[model samples]
Target: MTIIATLIVLGVLIFVHELGHFMAARSVGIRVDRFSIGLGPRVWGFRRGDTEYVLSAIPLGGYVKMGGMDDQVMERIEGGAVAEEEDGAAGEGKVQPGRGSADASRTEAVPSAAGRRRDSDFDSKPVWARAWVISAGVIMNMIFAFFAYTAVAAGWGSAQADTTRLGQVVVSFLPEGTEELEGVPEGAHFTRIGDRAVEHWGEVREAILDAPAGPLTFQWDNPRGEITVPMPADAEERRRVVMGLRYWVEPELIFVEPGAPAHRAGVRAGDVVVAVAGERVHLWSQVQDLIRASPGREMEVVVARNGEELSFSVTPSSVDGITPDGEPQTIGQIGVQAQNPPITYTRVAPLEAVQVGWSETVFVTGFILNFLGDLVTGQVSTRNLGSIVTIGEASGQAAAEGLPVFLSFMALFSINLAILNLLPIPILDGGHLVFLGIEAIRGRPVSAEQRMRWSQVGFFILLGIMALALGNDFLRLFGL
Candidate 1:
């Protein structure tokens, strides 16, 4: 399934990119000899007029072949014209049908302008037109990315942190273990921390962290009631208090493994873990910590089911799992998964998709560029770079998890593909555009030797990056 999805995504991206070049070439009156999807041996193909369309065996990358684009090939194709012979034979029939002198006279006639135009046509096109023809592929990829992003944003909505202010007190997703003594519930409006009003989560955390050791007071209100809790006497102990609450964000419970702690404790799909071990549970991290701390220990679990408060005792069990840093650890297992928040779609007028799509396309392009820059500068690690194998693994994991996750993964991969193909290097659309730019400025195309040298360098650089990405993938996959 992962392989299929990856191929489909890559194929669509590549096709859109190639289509850009094809369309631009046709628009500029440049002849395209072939437009191929994929590479290597043709699985299926057909010639239509002057162009041959092909679906190749390898489902990775594609290309467009244009007439007069290659000097040597164009020369051969143009010089091999049998038109003079045919025209001579026709003319000879009028003079003397079977005479050798008739044929000799016909062979001496000048070649038509049409034949010469066909041979030198593409090279004769304006530099600007040629540049556009070469650059169309990258432009199309950008356009595709924009549409895909807009579709996802409009369909699924965007994820953003809540930035609303009420007072000095801020609402939390889950109560910290130390904050548990404060008796704050999830969704509780914190009005004041000690003497200061809390306006944001950051402020709330700061106040908590900087609180005076003795009897720190918190003023809050929940749907049921308002209350205040006092901090402990020990300043160090108070610092250890974990406010496990998260800001209010909609998320679904998507999966529950059979016989797992969550299942055994009667936690089912659609049940929200409102609080765990009396801590307001906001994100997965808080829930995970609670489970990890109480492995094999029974604790009170509070869940919100269809607007009803339900309480159950769950005994967290130890399970073997790999950490993000590639360390094996025994962590508490609940065998539960969360669903992505539901997306609210707003249908727009047809024209809006274009504007929205364009903005999204530019944003994605910029984002990819920034990310690569960061990676190169060591601001981000090489581990963040993923190969096709890593993408497939992610897809498989998401698929095993649920539909929302899978869809999200697909969106990310699509954006990544669009960005990666737009890099200004030889063997890419950007590289071709660079050559075109040189031609436009110099009034002549780049020499084959220069292009070949640059292409070789580009290939080596690309191979190195691929190797690093694949190594990262292997390390992640096998928990190395």
Candidate 2:
């Protein structure tokens, strides 16, 4: 299932990216020789007109081959002839087919004008046109991500911003040497903390922040039942009294993986999980633990939706997991996530949805840029880098969760693809843009030998990055 999901996700993203190039080439009158969705030997393909659309064996990346793009190949494509493109030319020229000897002689008598290059050749296009062609792929990916995000937001509705209900309980160590409480489970609602009535998470936060320094009593409604915990008396410990607890907007269904137990049982987004196996729950962690502990066992689930309660019986699925002790273990998984619920949620108008989607895209774009900067500056670890394997695992997990989650993942991947391709490194779209920029400034293209040398360098750099990412994937998967 993970493999399938990964392929689908990657295929869609790669296809959209390549399609952008193909369309731009056609629109700009450049002849595209090949439109491929993968690398390496051709697995399957078909030709249409002048272009061969191929599905290659290596599913890592794809490319669009355009006429006159490769100088060596272009020589053969042009029948051992290279047309001298006239400077400042914009439009395409007509091809005179099947010229007779007499016609050839007559054509030779008329002097060729500057800017009279083949319409279908890549180099014959104006610099701006070429720039657009190189950038089209990134543009398409961004556009695709925006629409996808918009659809997801519109369909699921935005998280209500003013929601005050508790969504999760963050259980952590209270300070050392403090009163050790027992049986304090996560997924509890904060009804009150030290006799301060809590209507919203903000109130809870304020109360915790301003409480007098002393042993404090924390009150919350646990899934099993209502419980109260005595906090540590130490001043520092009292200041951090709410470390193990978190108040959220509302308890809502945030994730449902496709083909997972929850998905199979018809669990969906917007459905508020109220109980697991008849036990009332407030935190997503409680639901996660319950599912994780019940491999292959059917459990009753109750969710609230639109003021109505619905029930489902879900059997947890077996999946590979690692224990805290670094031992391989088979854990039960229902393919759901309850943590990170939105502070507020509500429906949006179509225009609002579009606005939100665009904003999200912009935000993600900035995030990727910042992440890249951090990576280069060593502020972030190389271990954070990932490969196709990582993508596959994540995509598969998201697919199991459900469409909304999967689509959201797809959007993120698309943004990643775009940003990565736009990096100003050799052998990438950004590299080509840099070369073109130099050409525009110098009034001529870089020598083929120079381009070739830089391309090789880029290839080595890319190989190193890929290797590092692969190593990270292996380490992560094996708990090494």
Q: Pick the candidate with the highest TM-score.
A: 2
Error of 1 at 3 (Å): 3.1
**Candidate 1 minimal-lDDT segment of 10 residues:** 100-109
Candidate 1 matches the true fold with a TM-score of 0.57
RMSD of 1: 13.5
Off by over 4 Å in 2: 71-117, 159-346
* Per-residue lDDT over 24-96 for candidate 2, one digit per residue giving the tens place of the 0 to 100 score: 8899897766677876555787877877677866687777766554422122212221112355332222112
Error of 2 at 309 (Å): 32
When summed lDDT is taken over every stretch of 10 residues in candidate 2, the lowest stretch is 99-108
Give the per-residue lDDT of model 1 (tens digit) for 1-480: 867766766777778878888898889886665676876555787878777677766676676656543322122212221112554543211111221110000011112233454532355567677667766776776666666656655564442323212221122322233444334555566667777776555455556677765556667655434444555555544434433334444334777755566777788988877788889875655666678767677888887898998898887765444443334456665667776433334455556655656665566657777778766766555666878876665666767645544554555555676567657777555665677778778877777667756765766777798899898666544333
TM-score of candidate 2 relative to the true fold: 0.59
lDDT of each: 0.58, 0.67
lDDT of 1: 0.58
Query: How do all models score by TM-score?
Result: 0.57, 0.59
lDDT of 2: 0.67
Per-model tally of clashing residue pairs: 22, 15
